[model samples]
Target: MAKQHKIIHVDMDAFFASVEQRDHPEYQGKPLIVGGQPDSRGVVAACSYEARQFGIHSAMPCARAYRLCPQAIFVRPRFEAYREVSGQIRDIFWRYASEVEPLSLDEAYLDVSYTADYNGSATLIAKAIKRDILKETRLTASAGVSYNKFLAKIASDMDKPNGLYVIRPERGEKFVETLPVGKFHGIGPATEAKMKQLGIETGLDLRNKTLAQLTERFGKAGHYYFNIARAIDERPVRSSRTRKSLGKETTFAQDITSVTELTTKLLDLAEIVLESLAKQKLNARTVTVKVKYSDFQQITRAHTLDHSIALGDLREVIPMLLARTEAGKNPVRLVGLSLSGFDAGKSEDRQSQLDLAFSDPF
Candidate 1:
């Protein structure tokens, strides 16, 4: 039999909030929410394990979170502190696998099929990584070990907050069979509700559904659902998956219907996006502007530049793209600018050359 692919998924327990608690020992046992001010027009970024007990979660409105647990500490996000520890965790992952796919600053997938440590056992590697993270950063990381990405991802979530779980190849099918279809990765609340309506409540229930039926209902995602039900996922742990875009956006305290005001905000957002690209060592040719009106309708306009817009050029390009929107006529609640179509392995000068060949003539 061919050797199974060994994969490990690492997720930091309550990443942002945990970092704050680690740095400030006094906050060790308190419910903590890190995000905008409770009264601000923003959402929760991350909450501590304690805060989740109050039914708060990421992306919940901060004001609503406050209403749930009035005593919870609501601090503005400290991304710098979170990112520093993120680096610490990645360093530990690199020690074990040559191919590490970072899903975010706090979580990643590692392919260790041919690893030399622990005689090529992935479970041992996971334990080592969790131990290293605890020792170096004073943080806890949960790990899941399996033979492929799907099982590995599922395994990680089975145990929470600094626990480890494993899904063995021989038991993969049985493990998935008893699992709830909604618990499968990528099945969000909306889809879960749809599944419940279909009476496809468990993996066995999902497996019984014909491909034609699922495809008719869920489209392309049906194929994925069908495969994961059988413990037959083949997606590799990709190390070179390049990011498609980077952006920054903000919500105003009050909607404004002024073109000049919207342009100013996009310029600020463009500067932030440029700094992010520089930090990631990436260059992009496509510039896009996103506008959200007070009515909750949103639209995007993109302009492909002749060359990668240099930091100095974003100010001009952003306004040009913004002009394509109903800026002055629409009361705008949010504005964002993004850059995409990264040309990997190219320096800024070469990327500039490649993009200019296709830049918009207008």
Candidate 2:
């Protein structure tokens, strides 16, 4: 029999807002938002727990967030400060587990299946990591422990804001039975709605569907859904996954038609994409512009250069790409900028380009 894997997913509690509140004592326990100003055409990058109580969430328009809670404090993101703290947290991960897969700056998955620390108890190790993080950084973290990544990720969210929840091997399938299909990590909003239409509201509802039935509906993702419903996930915790693309995009609360407004938004996106590239020390030869019209029609225009793209290059190329589409003439609801052609030397069969969803409200 194959041995079960032990995985722990650690997620920081309201990372950006918590960091801001920690730095400014006056902001503690108060609703705080980290993104652009309420007056600017920006979205909420992150919000405090207090802010969430007012029905505010990330990717919401700052203007709407202001309307939700006029007393909420809005501030720009301090990426440098957040990165420093993330590095510190990563250091703590290394001390506990040799295999750590970081999903983002504030969340990671650690495989402690073979670690003898805490007498090989993944649950104990998770607790220790959480304690160490709070002791060193004065920040709270929530953790989920389970035998596989799928359940582990779900368990992490069961109790949040300095929580540690565990799903044992015996209870994994049972735990998923009552979970809403919408809460499953891989199922997005659109998929959840479709599932609801098909009467797949919970894991048990999904589990009742035969492999053939599910495959007929969800295609390749059907296999994943079928197995996870039974609490079986064979995927390993890959420590060397490479980032293939980095992109940023924003959805406007109201559709925009002005060329000047579109250009301004593109420039803002470019600045953010450039900063991410500089931070990761990466360069790309391909840039793709995504435009979604008010009618929900979406299109993309791409330019591939012989050399890496720079700010000056974007300034020159973006307008030309926009011209290629009917962006200014058409009312657009979303605009995206993506950088690809990262020169990771892996074989084509082994390589997959993953697009990082843009969460920076522009």
Candidate 3:
């Protein structure tokens, strides 16, 4: 029999906003927002608990957030500071577990099934981690402990603002039965409505359906749903996840069919993508241009380079790549560009250098 994996998921509470407040105590209890300006086309990247009281959250349009509370404090993101803190937290995780999977700068999953430290108690390790994070950075982290990745991720969200919740194997089945279908990790609003239409509102309701019945309705996702509804997940907490690509896109306020107009828009997107690559200090060997017509028909054209393309060369390469697409032939609604094929070694080196630069020497 395979050993049950002990997993811990740690998610920072209002990470970006919390960092901002810690750095500037005056904003601690205020409704603070961090992201693009309210007057621009930016969206809320993260908001404090105070701002959440007004129904504002990450990814909401800044304009709407402003309308919700014009008095809220807004500021741009400081990625350097955030990355520095992320490194510090990851260091604490490393001391307890060798298998740590970072979901982002603010959250990660740690697998400590075989570690004998703390007498093999995942709960004790999680508590120690939260304590260390608070002592080192003056920021709070919430943790969820479970036997697998799926349950651990879900458990982390049960409480907020420096919370720690655990789902023991004995109660896992009963716990899942009462959970809403939408609350399951992969189920979104659209799937929830579909399940509701089928009279499956909760995990117990979902478990009532046979694998064949679910497969017939949800396709491949049905097989996944059937297992998770039973609180059985075999997925591992992968420690080496690679970033495959980076890209940027924009929706135009108006559609245009002229080639000249399309070129102008594509150029703007290329510049942004190149700037992102420069910031990461990486190079790419492939370029792709995506186009969506006014009718919402989307298509992409890609070009692979014999050599990696530099920032300055993109201005010339973008026009060449755009010519391969159907941008001017139809009214275009959106334009996007992407770059990939970075050398894995270089990317790792760049990340290490960045983490060190942001970390405190003391």
Find the candidate with the highest lDDT and give its number: 2
Candidates sorted by lDDT, best first: 2, 3, 1
Would you list the C-alpha lDDT of every candidate in the order shown? Answer: 0.82, 0.84, 0.82
The global Cα lDDT (0 to 1) of model 1 is 0.82
Best by TM-score: 2
Off by over 4 Å in 1: 241-362
- lDDT (tens digit, per residue) of candidate 2 on 76-186: 999987996786687667556647899999999987776656667888889989987886577899999998999889999989889999898889899989999999989
Provide the clash count, candidate 1. 3
Better of 1 and 2 by lDDT: 2
Q: What is the TM-score of each candidate against the true structure?
A: 0.66, 0.67, 0.66
Q: What range of 10 consecutive residues in model 2 has the weakest lDDT sum?
A: 353-362
Over 1-362, each residue of candidate 3 has an lDDT whose tens digit, in order, gives 45567899999999999999987889989999999998999999999999999999999999999999999999999998799678667756765664789999999999877555576688888898898788657789999999888888899999998999999888788999999999999999999999999999999999999999999999999989999999999887778645555665666667888877777777776776666566556678998888878886778888778787775667777778777777778889777777888755675754564343211100
Off-target runs (Cα >4 Å) in candidate 3 are 241-362
Q: Ten residues in a row with the worst lDDT in model 3? A: 353-362
